[model samples]
Target: MFRYYFLVIYTVYMLLKHIKLLYELQTLDPRLSYAKQMEAVYDKPKSFMRGCIGLTGSTVSIHQFGKTPKGPVLYVHPKLKLADLAVLLGHLDKTPSFFAEPRAFRYPLVHQWLNKMGAIKKNGGEHTAVEQIEEIVRKGQSFILSEADGIDYESLSSRLGVPIVPIETSGIEDMQKGSFFKRLKPADLDLTIHRAYLPENKRLRA
Candidate 1:
């Protein structure tokens, strides 16, 4: 009886694994599409104005600031209009978005597929700018904006095998001169909402 039960459980586990992989494969196109759209929005090849957006102090307000040689100058005010924010985030319903550490994807098969499709590249050039940022801080001088001018953030993220947010965090840590980070709690909410809900059998394993 014990041997029969063990065999049945093993079979079910394998079945669930393959099923999950298949479902991920089906969603590949939408994921790729969203990635492309984000690239289009954030990175304008011909736009010469270099800027970054961040929260201003503890206030609820935020600032879109131009990166300058001396310091960041406020370029835009308060908040984005509802319509503009919606246009920026319109792709959220089509697919899930979150920050994943470099080379640490929850779905290995999906990561492999993305690489095969040329959605991201893992060349040695990855993190070159990140390392440069660290070195600039070591010399006790400001790393001016011009140092990073003309670099495409979307392309850099692709090469680094992660999202742009991680790059932001990397620069932040270097500026603060230490690391203060913890892994965020993982949940199945994105999977469920995106209609790629995991099989019950694989939940615990995942």
Candidate 2:
């Protein structure tokens, strides 16, 4: 009876593991349309992180800033107007997206379980930007803007090898009605995507 039960449990565990892997595979994919844009832009490549961009400090208010839950994970990127940032993400092909061993368990459940069982220590603690390129930030899709923004943010960009883009948009009367950033009417937003950063090099522009 015990042997049969053990075998049954083992089979179920393996089946679940396979199912989880498949689920992780499906959710972790680059956006197709955005992927094309990334290839074109990168062919004439502007920055190391082709799709990701950094926003200005003033624009960071649109997001709710808070610390990430402490576990085996690390919190990167501050946020604001994630919807707006979505408009700018670049897409990548499968080749560049997954060229290495994945960082965390492709499935969050496995990551959490292993961490709880003391099988894994510090989730994001052991990861590098390359492993995450396919997991968190798709190679092609532009990055979601994070919390704090400024010259300091260049460090994160440098680490990720992505570009920084600052946008000056119109139609801000509602957001900055009482402040100096207020505008009366909608107009064309001027956006400049800065050059990409190499992890080991210094940039000419500040």
Candidate 3:
């Protein structure tokens, strides 16, 4: 009986130690901790920009949603490409009035790609999929793509009190075709979510 008890205690201690190690590792790396990142960005006025919005579609541009400056914001869509980044940069240059999330001028991917061309260490960290996402949203940024409608944008917006500028995108297969004009589409105009915390006074406009 004593032997069994000792073994059980040992097992429990080992499990707890493992869990503690994981928690410590996660806490040590800000890139691995989305909640920490979100808390860091929330309420930081210096990062916020008024009336500025981000735009992107689906897999390729999903990273855009995680980019935020600090203030009244929204996102526009239809999947974008390298050229779209250039165009957006031009727009930012032309209109100091607006700040766009995931500023095309400072794209992480562009930096990574350039580094790759030069044989430098370029891939971003290997964070878990959910952590990567949570880091993005909690940081007061929004994304245009979701596996389902309800999970990401709505939940994050409700938690952060940030309005989501949701936009739909064609699936990955349709997006690979390289035609510029063919890719842009007017987003689906009528989508709604019935949430308890959403401000009861304001109606989502078309």
Candidate 4:
């Protein structure tokens, strides 16, 4: 009985230790300084992203939240390509943004395959996966949601009781251009999130 009890205690301690280590690693992710530079070049105050939802089709343009925004902000993106996402994420204005990784992406089999193929790149968040981030948003903390498509955004807002700013990335023109090397350049691409429908209270603020 004593041996069993000892084992239980040891397991609990190790679990706590693992959580702590994960958090520390998260904090170590480098902040993207280029976010400011991008802002300077564009200098279009009108293109700034506001907290809202619903957009027609979707468009991609370079966006870096410039101001220190008030209230809970959720940034959603259909970030599929690992390299493109890395560029966008690295330039985000917010620090230590929580990233919600889909459970499938975290599955051992999928994770191993992606990692081996250089598809599973890190984007600075240690507390990954949807459930973990859902808890964070519940506590009224803002995050960069790692969900793609309209359905995921709607579901997340319903589940969390907060507005999500949808970011839709496109390379229609860039892809048409057909420069293989250019397509690979993260800096060359544009990023956009929607702002079609604004809440009543939010409408007043804007």
Clashes of each: 0, 19, 10, 1
lDDT of 4 by residue, 1-206 (tens): 33334434653454354444333433333453333322232222112121000011223456534343444556766655533444345444442233324553565333432232123224434434455556545544556656542235555665666665655555534422234323211123466645422332343122
Return the candidate ranking by TM-score, descending: 4, 2, 3, 1
TM-scores for the candidates: 0.20, 0.28, 0.28, 0.40
Residue-level lDDT of model 2, residues 134-205, one tens digit each, is 233333344333344222444555555554433222222232222333222222222233323334465422
Weakest 10 consecutive residues, lDDT, candidate 1?
50-59
The list of candidate 3 runs beyond 4 A from truth reads 1-76, 85-109, 112-130, 140-151, 166-202
Q: What is the Å distance of residue 141 in model 3 from its true position?
A: 4.6
RMSD of 1: 19.8
Q: Which segments of model 1 are wrong by more than 4 Å?
A: 1-110, 124-206
List runs of model 4 lying over 4 Å from the truth: 1-69, 96-130, 146-151, 170-187, 193-205
TM-score of 3: 0.28
- lDDT for model 3 comes to 0.32
Q: Candidate 2: lDDT of 193?
A: 32
How much lDDT does candidate 2 score?
A: 0.32
